[model samples]
Target: MTQKRDLENKDGPSAKKVNLEFKKEEIEGFFNDKIWDNKFQEEIKEQVEKSQPYRWGTITELMNDELLRNVRQEVLNEIAFKKKETDIYKVHQSGDLANLSGLDWDDLSRLPSLYKLRAGIYSEEFRDMISRITGSGKLSGVKTDMSINTYTKGCHLLTHDDVIGSRRVSFILYLPDPDKKWKPHYGGALRLFPAIVPNVPKTDYEVKLVPQFNQIAFFTVQPGLSFHDVEEVRADKHRLSIQGWFHIPQEGEPGYIPGEQEATEARSTLQQLQNKELQEYDFPKPIRNDIPADELKLYRGLGQECAFSPEEYSYLRKYLNAQYLEPKNLQRLADVFMEESLVELGGILNDELAGKLMDSIRDLEINTKAPAHSSEIHFPWKCAMPPHKQRFMYIDGKESLEASEEGIKFINRTGPQELPNFQLTGKAATNTVEELFCQICSFFKSIAFRKWLLFLTRLIPTSDQILLRRFRPGSDFILATSTDSKLARDNTDEINALLEATFNFTPTATNSKNWESGEFGGYELCMSSNASDDEDEEDDPAIYRESDPNDDSVLYTSQCKWNSLCLMLRDPSILKFVKYVSVNAKGSRWDISCQWNVESSDKDDEDEDAATS
Candidate 1:
């Protein structure tokens, strides 16, 4: 109320205008004089043209400091922000600032400074200046767009190129604590990533800009190339900013073209779904190599037996809960899985192994430092590539390799081997986490475990790939994606599906106070792909749908838990993702994930048929 009272007298009569319009002559009055300087404008143009990774530029003291400060105050006091989280981002965002012009007098009166700020930003003078600096051509004054966002501790926007419909420029005007310097350690920097090709972003960011109050960062929206992400906020402070985009001129505006917007949309990142060539650039592709002949034969033979052997029981007892080994319990599990196609088992590991794992993970979280940077991640661990889709640390039981243009192409063309082996880590595998994870991976891949899985699911695995993964707090996640279409092609004998299993070893207590309610993220979610309808198939598969509670689209929600295992039969139509871990999480979401191409079992189907009769 005091800020509003102060603003009422600051601009007097002009502030009450129903349709606020910025005059060309008043440019210097609304923005910093430095931006209007011709020499400064040319320097900015040059800097943007030569910017590394991609074309981008920044302006410090971009707006009239006093006016912008007043606007920030108005935004903080008058605007109501709602927290929204999806697979791609998490932030508290105010409703679109573009609607400020439509507000009634009573509502408008509450945010005069914010209204003035929006008008000044979309003013013809400022738009021209931005256009010239970024060489993004003409920008429309009519199609104004903006929203205010506050990135408090744990909030983030993951890697994305600002390419949708007719967007020419993207900018963020920072409004943090004006008097204090925004530190790099606070972890709210705007990071830019290089692309291996057009659509594939590199595993690591190549550049970052730590923003301060009144500093505006802007870039030309290059399809697939201009990739960037907002690093997660780690400090208990608001990193507030007004984010907006300048679109190509609309009809009746200067430089408007009849079909330019359509042309731009045609080239958007979403179009990659229809382009098979671009799909090759994606990393950790759903390339599940065919199972080795001998291995397949062994599993098929074991599937005929109803129970485990003495040798098999001894091998499994080293890792599995004793109760799960009981024939009656195993039969019950198989029956449940056959009916529902999925099951979640808690206390999955034996007491000794589980205790050792929990202790090692808790120690890693409390004492040893986690790798916050890609370069710091060493042996037995590798960072997943192409940050636009996923970011996490994993051991795929192979030699660690950097993602290069040649490497991406090589893997795409030749295809990698079917099974993973942890022997590549050698001496480096001695660390408790690595050692335990390797044993787990090996256990999942072992013939003994395959036999157990066969009796439990009545499906024979034809191929397998196992990974020991750590989704670190604030820095890792896999965006929602469906199983690869290739899974269906792996086997011609019967209807094939991916028999997937995740053994969670996250040390966080699963109570509501910690991770159970999903506030701190680190949840693995599975949903119906919704790809059945012909109309829905055209929708971008990567976009997260806000499912209605009554809808059956959400198949399962697995919160971060300690010593639990989730088993599911995944067809190509099931979508899944691990939610981005918040900085507030107790530790990383630790798990060994296993995937196998499984042939449907006629035996289980007949048993169900008989029971129903």
Candidate 2:
């Protein structure tokens, strides 16, 4: 284990000289002399200008080596870090550095190197240099923003463009072990993603930078173009770094433009809606296809009668537990579901099928290596796109991979032809994990199971989609988001909520404690939604309120488990997310997720009784 150290009590040699004031001449001494070289400056500017995906650049030996080393030492010794986990990120972080200017004498003396480092970073001369290289216009030194983070194994940040508020430039200075070189496989690379248009980030990162000690990476805060993430730290080593942003020029600063910040905020609000065309760019779009008339007629005819035919029972018995199929048990479960609009069944699958599934999944997990890159993932399994919203590998019953715009259009188009037919695929299943999951998908979509579902929930299925998802460790997650407005709209005559179910099949040894601790993520969480109607200042849809674990807003949290199913009726006000699977997880989070547009089974009966009267 790594030994812990506290902040040094002794002041450094420059501690007495350093104060809250910034001097132009002093800046040159703080940074490497190469930074002031005309040739180096021009080359860096050119690099930023020609960079792909977005304008960005990196500088090696960014600061005075000794000074930065001391800064790193002081940070590790003095600052206490709190573990922060949210929909988009998970890491240990120190408090905001914006208050460094007001620190009392004792505190200031203790963090002299840190204070000096901060001053050097936000000095007028340094900000001007950054402004020129990135061509992002003048930045305000007064509004200094910075935070120190130590991303040990399992820490990660999901894809997002840094477009919040008045941020003009986003930069990170690496402070990992100065003596050793950081390697690519260590997994703390800064990955940059290219966008399909402006707001939609591609499914995978095209470029990544593995930072070394004293290296700094910075980019202009383009609203949609500057999409990036910190790849999960796969190695058991501390990856220390300082993250900060240079803000737009403030009222008293040079190059200050009145109302510029407000205009940017307004534009950001417009971008959030993404317009209708942009919505098309999102993969596995929220648009649920309407059910066919024949299925609708069948479901309506079965109203109030939860009875299953012998043939239907036989078919369902192959997948579901025998007890679940018994009429008394079904009615008892239905009573519970009806009262709460939710139910979780343990050992949901029959012993024969469940044992086989657990074995196959375990074999696949232990014997076969999971794909590390998006490109390495093969068909039947496609990577989810527009990764800022979600990042996971899924089998959505599509025969061919469809990631292009034309492909999205074809899949999302109105028609029963585009609807998934997992049964057809299950016919060819070879008992592999993929085939077995496909079979599970088919079971959920089966008409016989729909009748069993009607008994369990008293809801008539209108339309459905079933997905087999694999949340791989260190790579996949779904951020907090609510049901699509179109599907969740409150209509007295129509469905107000969607019936959802998740069949968890994460294989784990009985004694393993990783999944239960919630330390390795891969949990499904649902919270009361805080989405607002105000366009100009909508709440951040991705982050939970500072992500307090004890907050009552979290309605449910289901850990990765084996042979369990969770059923719930989700309205528009509910937010859900699959936490990012940590690299330390025992295995991938395997599950079959099913969704349906459903109406109350009693609705048709009431209509018929009124007509008869």
Candidate 3:
């Protein structure tokens, strides 16, 4: 019965063409005219050429203040934004503005300033001006991709060289609180990392720019050397910006080199990281298992239901948290483990011991300055090797001392290594902080704990690796990996021997609430393996996100919390990683990660053996 009125005067003779001329001066008013001035353009060009890590540049007051301020207001008033968290970033993103052409006039009227800015960005005068300065060549005016984003407290983006299917340039124009200055200490700075080689980035960053309203930052999309991250925002204020890319021209467009995009993809960071020679550095060190005869025998006999022996219970009473010692709690955990293949136990340590450990660690973190280099950390605090896959402080039961470059080279060059049996479990002799951690590492290797684990999961360890890990803020993490390094046996579907656990020792202050919004950092995430049969054996999940997290593939995830112990009877198909601890994290995410070569009891094999008997 009702019809919406069209914005067009359909009966008018000129309605079909509707050429309302937008003057050049109107477009010029959208940006700072000085940017197009020859002298400034040359300065910008030279700055890009000399930039560290890779070529990149930023211009403050890039757009006229009033116009950008109005654009920011329009965006905040009209756009719906949602928090999107994935492996690479945590940000609030607006719907992509790529289809601005389809917007009804009423909607367009509300976003007029945003349209003006977008148009100015793609205007020939601006595009060519950017091309000549960055030497990126001409850009495609028909293909614009941009979205508004707000990174409030805790939001961040991990390091990545933006070499995806891109035409040419990557850019971000900030629209943070105009009246306030975005300070460096407030944390959301654009940080750039240098490369040690063409594809490998140095552990630390060399360049950073604090965001400010009306500032525009851009970089040529180099394959690997352009490693960068958006530091977690720490202030109460929001750091809003518009980010997108300019593609190399499409067909029928000025800069369309026929095979340019394909050639660029060939040299993409994803491609570079997948190179054979480069994979020698992937982490979760190449260790395999060699089940001891005695350990294998214990596993076979443990059967469907098992429990800690009286002596083993007594031994644990002195060390473990009282709650886990309760038979009911242990039984509940066992039931869950049997059903889901994973379990979480809270209050896993005795209060007195936990208090002492907490006090000692707090004192150490406050008093003992952590070493500047991985090699500088003391014996028991050996740093995990290879920055690409993971980097954190850890001490193995074998007490792997600080790794040397030469030793790392040896490990990488050597073939698959064997996991150590608990032979060194009792070697630790002291009670100092250094020895305290070693003692726990040894405890993980102890026959009593091994027996308890067997009673709980009916899984026996052929060999074990215990690590005391310390993830400092802004510093550590493990990228996901699938180790089908162990062969699937007659009794199992996958190499399900990896019984892994994380005994979180983070203080009460850094619970999920502090980082649930993900600003403060230190969360543990797990996903189903992304490993493909087609990719080479050397391929592992990229330290980057392979796909959107919303895609149903993520299996389970947890954030850092105090006194919680996580157990996963993992198959080689399970991929796991600890999210990077932001520099803004209140404290280190401390934990003991234990891995065992477990022989889980298979129902079919047990039934066959029983029937035969």
CA lDDT of each prediction against the hidden true structure: 0.80, 0.81, 0.71
**TM-score ranking of the models:** 2, 1, 3
Would you list the clashing residue pairs of candidate 3? 154-519, 167-248, 321-349, 321-350, 474-582, 474-583
Candidate no. 3 TM-score? 0.81
Q: Write the per-residue lDDT of candidate 3 for residues 311-339, one digit (tens) a residue.
A: 88788887787667666776788889989
Which candidate ranks first by TM-score, i.e. highest? 2
Residue 530 of model 1 has an lDDT of: 67
Candidate 2: deviation at residue 353, Å? 1.3
- lDDT of candidate 2 over 43-85, digit per residue (tens): 9999999998899999999999999999998888778788878
For lDDT, the strongest prediction is 2
Global CA lDDT computed for model 1: 0.80
- Candidate 1 local lDDT, residue 610: 100
Question: What RMSD value applies to candidate 2?
Answer: 4.5
lDDT of 2 at 29: 88
Give me the displacement of residue 402 in model 2, in angstroms. 3.8
Q: RMSD to the native, candidate 3? A: 6.1
Candidate with the larger TM-score of 1 and 2: 2
- Estimate the Cα RMSD of every predicted model relative to the unseen true structure: 4.8, 4.5, 6.1
Model 3, residue 565: distance off in Å is: 2.3
